[model samples]
Target: MLPKGFQYAGVYAGLKDNGKKDMGVIVSERKAVCAGVTTTNLACAACVKRARKILRRGAAKAIIVNTKYANACTGKQGERDDAEYAKIAEKLFGGPVLTASTGVIGQNMPLDNIRRGAELLKKELRDDYDAFAEAILTTDLVVKKISKTVQILGRDVTVAGVAKGSGMIHPDMATMLAFITTDADIDRGLLQRIIREVTAISFNQITVDGDTSTNDMCLCLANGLSGVRIDRQALPIFQAALTEVLIYLAKAIAADGEGATKLMEVNVTGARSLKEARLAAKAVAGSPLVKCAVYGGDDNWGRVIAAVGRSGARFDPEKVRMNWDGLQSKTVTINIDLANGRESAQAWGCDLTEGYIKINTKYN
Candidate 1:
């Protein structure tokens, strides 16, 4: 379920030839504080640019998203299309709106279809969270969503999120899109800070094919409808709850990677700093050799060691302790001790299989 004061709707946009639900909207009854983090890729989608601009205002009332046409690499026309979508959303929803798109880069968006879909979405706006989740997917096989209620200030605050991604995923922000909604009252600056911190440990620690996409993004909206102001005393609790939601969605994305048969977890400990630990963990998670070894169920700890060695993290191989027994349970935990400090980090990824190659080779 979505947080209070927000309505969601998903409709078939004709952007996808299969007539799948390709457009969705989330509208808040009142203005909400919003913060977003987008892909660092140079070839970003127009929707990403538009969302950044809207977030600069520090608040928003609606979010419009479409899948199956990423609107990336379409040059100036793509920017126009994104602007038009925002305009349409604002006109219909009566407030500022942000936009997001995913799927099929280097192609022009079907503007006419998007316009029609916007109309249908307006009419279908309701509390259909499942439909909204289904509409935001491109190649994803499952709907990734989580909802949790936490007590703050003697009131129940709800936090819910949805995400979509399957392939072209890596650590510099996974090839994924996530939107989180909450009913806790929080300051914009603090909310943004929490989002960045949570993202660093959650979304930034996952990988699939080691290829980042041009449309990756994660956004959060706090509508404060629960009448609970998150003071400093409660910030830690709220942040933990929010992090839990993001980590769940992140793991779901990795486990559901295209043609993935199992999930892999890499742990890096005793690093000199958090940065070193993250670098080492992500390197191991994104290493194709390590991924293949996991897929074959081979006790190839050498590949894991090689990945960490090349990760640019200062580590002492003599102090590294690897445990491959976790492979029997479809989990691989590699502990690398740099013998430098006490910082540690973990990353999640999926094994590479023949099916992954087949899926990507024929994907269009």
Candidate 2:
């Protein structure tokens, strides 16, 4: 199902040994005002660099994505492959295209298949966003998509999003690629700023594995067809809608983390700053000790305490407090209230079971 005017296509590009669906496209009839965020990994993929360059110019009519080889650390060959793919997309869309790539790291792309796949997508672009969602998944077991509508000053608008990733997760921005499209016309500067803010709290707030992917990408496109131009007054409403979509996808990614058996929420409260809170949460969320405990359903609050200690956040351990299960049950009170802190925020993750180990060891 599609949310609205968005058109999509997914097909095999021969980028993997099994000949699974690899190439996909998301397109709009008119240029879409776009904002994108990529991996901060110094070793980013060629496709990541190319997409940023294109979106920097103006609006985009299409997003070309593939899953198989990450096309990272392949040097000059990777750059050439991404350039060729962009050219193929440009010809097919007859307009500017945004490219996104994912899969195994430090690998080269099969440019021939990518070019052929782009041609195929041109012929099949339809209103099937689900097909597009299925095409981009790697280790994920299910396709992720969500859409919502809200009224802004008596005007109706829609926000539709799709995402993929279940492993290599924690890759820059949780190793996922989410493409969102809206019919609202927005200024590029404002759109970029808002997208960044929403993504930081959603996609960037979750993790499974600690490794960041070289080709991570999360982008949103606003074609402004709804005639609801976002003013400063409308910005908060817009950001809230965007953040909701991203957080939904982020939780889905964690729940489906390869072989994950238990979804866990690690919340850090009473921090002096948001950044420190995030850092503390990340440390707790990524700690193997904490994950293993969750896997076994063991209420070991010490694991949480140890995680906080190593979180690189400035905190007086003697004055820190902790809780679990929403701070209601299985709660262990650590009387460190001398530090003057009492608010909380949550991070998403899952247990690191042997099942996860088995799946990653065998997955192609």
Candidate 3:
């Protein structure tokens, strides 16, 4: 419902034969405090590597992006696309620029279209969230946008976010490129803490597939357009709002997961520690074997249990437990109860199926 600020044009970048909107720009009207989280994949995309460096100063007024080709493995020239984008943003917006890209892997980036997209953006920048949403999606079945208005320093501030990932979405920093923008005045240190806290439980907690992307980037921009300062005192509120956006975007990504039909929430509990719990959960979430079982609706708890066992986390098999959509699957769940301790952790996830394979095949 964000009235779309930032005009957008989807001039067939030829990256996708479907002629979908691919290249786009989201520019804030003012300098905004920006916080971003990138993929931990050692072979990160050229765009992700550079976006992290650009957002370090906690400010970026414009974001340039493309979706047909992942700006990865392009060698030194790929590295150059990052700086080229910043330069593009500067030319169009007269401000600092941040860039992000996600699509086919190991393909050369489309720099000429990117440059043209920037020029098109300059001629048509507005407050239309729809245009922005359309521009960022690749293989997404629908447009994605999440926003919330909350009190910051006793003043109203808005946090709006959008993401695209119908595939390659195991976000240890999640495989999707998500950008969040807000109109709150926050310094870099506080912005970093809030973003870190928000992403930990939100983005880092979900997985459609075990595959993490090289181009995953989640960024938050706070331009103070709402006239509120998200000072340290108001950190908690800001964190909550940011977390809301992250969770929304993550779920949307999952719901739109390539060939995904039913979205799921797996909660892993009764672990000795949080880290152990997360490892166990991720193991279940990322397991294709477990996912296939879920896809078949076979009520398979052993796969879940097996995944947990292999997670390298400690837990008494007798003390571990499992549930499907909150109902205890007696024949399928694994539980190990601690004889004396009162600590445990839970994780979230979904099922996989042939439809997933079919979709990728069709899309390609």
Q: How many backbone clashes does candidate 3 have?
A: 22
TM-score pick, better of 1 and 3: 1
TM-score of each predicted structure versus truth: 0.95, 0.90, 0.87
Candidate 2 vs candidate 3: the lDDT winner is: 2
**Candidate 1 lDDT, 1-364, residue by residue in tens:** 4589998899998887777798999999899999878898889999988888877777999888988778888899999988898888899986788898887777788888889999999999887588889898776788898998888767788889999976432112225999999988999889988999999998989988777788999999999998888888999889988999999998889888888888888888889889999999999989999999888888687998889899888878888777765776756665666677899998999899987877777454
Q: Model 1: what TM-score?
A: 0.95
Stretches off by above 4 angstroms in model 3 are 1-14, 152-154, 168-175, 326-346, 361-364
Clashing residue pair totals per candidate (backbone < 3 A): 0, 6, 22
Model 3, range 1-364, lDDT digits (tens) per residue? 3412333334445555676666777787776677878888888888887777777766777777777677777788888777777787788785778878777666676777778777776766666667778877766788888788886556677788888875532112224878787777778778877787777766787787767778887887777666676656777887888778888887777666776655555566656677776676667767788767766666577877788789877777775555554223311232433222455543445557677776555454
On lDDT, the leading prediction is: 1
Kindly list the per-residue Cα lDDT of model 2 for residues 92-152, writing each as its tens digit: 8856788888876666777788888888888888876877888888768888999878778
Model 2, runs deviating above 4 Å: 1-3, 168-174, 326-339, 362-364
Best by TM-score: 1
- Cα lDDT of candidate 1 equals 0.85
What are the clashing pairs of model 1?
A: none
Query: 1 or 2, which is superior by TM-score?
Result: 1
Candidate 1 lDDT score at position 3: 80
